[model samples]
Target: MTMAQARGTTDGWPDGTFRNPVLPGFHPDPSVCRVGDDYYLVCSSFEYFPGVPIFHSRDLVHWEQIGNVLDRPGQLTLPPSTASSGGVYAPTLRHHDGRFWLIVTNCADGGGNLLVTAEDPAGPWSDPVRLPGVPGIDPDLTWDDEGDCWCTYAGIEQVRIDPRTGRTIGEPRRLWSGAPGAQAPEAPHLYRVGGYWYLLIAEGGTERGHAVSVARATAPGGPYEPCPANPVLTHRGTNRPIQNTGHADLVEAADGSWWLVLLGVRPGGGTPGWHVLGRETFLAPVTWVDGWPVVGGVEPVMAAPPWPARPTPQPPARDDFDAVGLHPRWVSVRSRPAESWSTTERPGWLTLRARGASMDERDVTFLGRRQQHPSCRVRTLVDPAGGRGGLVVRLDERHHHGVEVGDGEARVLVRIGSVLATVATRAVPAGPVRLRVDVLAPAPGDWHPGKEPDVLRFGVESADGTFDVLAELDGRYLSTEVAGGFTGRVIGMYAATGSVHFDWFDYQPEDGDGDPTPRDGGAI
Candidate 1:
């Protein structure tokens, strides 16, 4: 049986459970399509490879990572700066004429949105084709029963396209402007359910004022009328803590239940509210009441997850450095200067050779995904013959936490608002010492519970010195709510400046819990 067959049925979310965005932590601008009872969804990658992450869902609740839509350079390239928040934006995933299609905007070069598709999710995808003259952000496609396809985008414009050639079929038209059009409406999607064809859009830029609005009309091309309900979704009453709730893609479950997935950011930690893993993905329950869409725990239902228990289980996010290569989830924030990071160079460890002495704040590989979960401890064995290595929580080059074993001393870098201040440091013999980090994850519904404040800490254990707390992290001051980025917290390791190599890194999710593959390769 296939991955979808593993699940029994697809429908009826636990009313309130689908709250916020469905896919959380670093996945953003989601577009999902249903083929039979199986669901396939994709998200924009900006600078990360696998430009569009494709996921599979059966019940619309449980989701699995099927593969990436753009798997090769021929399809997409690793960007230097997709935009502080750009790169690949608003991707529309669809199935047309028996083939899979995904079109997106590559912002690194300010290139136009391009299209790529494959016979299967894990693809040898086709080369990207630049769209014909449509500009701005967020592009989506709608297919009618006649097999006619219409492309809707951020512009006040719509274009008909040839399903077979992936080219324009007719003159593009500037259709309807939503909510007086002043909302700077973007990320528009067109779909037909009943007698009414619905046009859903995101307006008010990507910040606290963001909203999901809708309109309806009799034809694909409109003189569309705004839904009677007006702004279907808003973050009005909620403070800036949950600010900026826009960019949405809606879907109908196999059981005819309606759901919408959008991109949202939670700013609560670090300076400027970090986007450690980048833009987070959210899903909200939506319903049509008198031809309008209502969002966020609409009456009988609760708010959606930044989309939730999709069709698949979260894949194994943990990895043992003992493996030959870095895990698939690992990404360098900026372009990697060198690929000398080879496991063969240092046996029994995934070694990352340090490069440029200082890196740009927005992009750095060391500033990896925020491990997502809270209360996790990561420890690594460093065979520092003469250089440096350590474990860290990286948001970018500027904001990061790590206990480094270098310069004959172990020091913890406390990142505070674009500055790295050595919070704690100690002298040790230092050659081949082990550095361990324990990051405290925030508990649900407990933002400021002091007894259990979401803080981070690090320690250095060595033959020369016993394990000692290098720094006691105070996280009450920061959160996704404060360090504003589009994603959740992820943690990893780093090597800086020169080519220093790292040894075994053991990530223990939930502090003190034994790591399944704790470093066995004793430190030199």
Candidate 2:
């Protein structure tokens, strides 16, 4: 069944359990805070324009994208030279006094850690207050009982800061490093719980060995005591479906219970499995044992919280391109200039003016959304007569797959590293044509002992509503393991030359039953 159909239904789950990764696909470094009965969450948006996507929920299980924190060009700017995963990093969201505050790191040139505040969570957030004094990524903000603010960052460092002026009140000092000998200690969060100030952090890199450790002290800056059971959460060296679990944030519910929101990946296929959906946000129960927090195991499914589940409606599967502005899910590479894309240029279509010659350039005029599901179908109606453009699934400039419509033909193209090749082509009549791509799960007999993550089938549809598949490529080439990056696959449309108008774009999540067969069959 489609994701929309699966929403709000509890079929086959009679034990009142909910699935993990509440926020799926490419949503990493999740930080959540609860204000009153509402919960707000923000995730790292590396290299994507309109950085830091934020969500709001009442039940914590049902999250809706209210808007992005850095929606204006003034708030975020990524030059064409910005690398694949080199723009915005981890963000910590918190509500203090009468406003919501966010602190994050921008890795782009002339960028550093910054803070923004708003009276409303879904808002016109204030322009960034650049924190030139903060010297690391994943900056976290917390306040002591006396209302003094402190900034904690990836180095496991801390400093007293004046939030209003973005100035450091004192020199930064080192905090407790995570579990002994852990590499790449980062993503630190300082919290004041009960009578002690707890410092939580992620270490051992963000790869397979990622883990979360904690320490506490009676004072914000003091001789802290490490939790006897440190490394509170981790999936390292395990056969579990979820891997690379760490970078967690804690929130206390109004009911006095606590929850942990963290990031993890579901790797598919064989040995040295590859993950294409990027790191996803997962939820787990947190209980205190001997004054130390104990994190529950993360799984594909787990028992529901004490409160009743409230599932929000999923976003529409199809975008008609009639709105005045792009939705929060829509994102572009590097930057999205006003002249580069528009919806009113063609009224009911999205018009994109090409800047780069092809997807090989980082400045390509492309707009896409994350591939949120393991198996899904994406298609777009494009009129190539105006210029050359079509639907593409991109990992980066060097790794992508696309179906190009130009010169009266629809050609399937694949780019892996330095190689870019046309796998198949088919001539089509003029006017607007439908181009489609299907990400299907791997079949049992697909590989002898080592299985592929998935198969991506690229093709076109005829007036009779039949899809003519052109080429099918292994999905591993577009995964994080093979691509050597921190991002996942983003599927959308682009203009390779001149101006191209997309009549509409539709994305639907398919059933994940490991069936490699095509849903529709027709000759090219």
Tell me, by TM-score, which candidate is best: 2
Instruction: Give lDDT tens digits, candidate 2, residues 1-524.
Output: 33443354533323577677789889999999999888999999999998999998776777889999999898998998899999999999999999999999999967699999999989899998989999979999999989999999987899998888899998999887877788988998888888889898999988899999999999888678999887899899998989999999999988999999999999888879989999999999999888889999898877877876656567898999999899999999989999999899889999999999999998999999999988888988999766899999999988999998988999998999999999899998678999999888765455434667888899998767688889888888999999987788899999999999899999988765366464443221
TM-score of model 2 vs. true structure: 0.96
Which candidate has the top score in lDDT?
A: 2
**How do the residues 276-328 of candidate 1 rate in per-residue lDDT, one tens digit apiece?**
33456666677667667777542212443344334355555345566775544
Q: Which stretches of candidate 1 lie over 4 Å from their true place?
A: 1-21, 78-83, 162-171, 239-243, 265-279, 296-313, 321-326, 336-338, 359-367, 414-418, 428-433, 441-453, 461-467, 474-488, 498-504, 508-524
Alpha carbon deviation, residue 361, candidate 2 (Å): 0.9
Candidate 2 all-Cα RMSD: 2.4
Using all chains and alpha carbons, the TM-scores for the candidates as numbered come to: 0.80, 0.96
lDDT for 445 (candidate 2) = 50
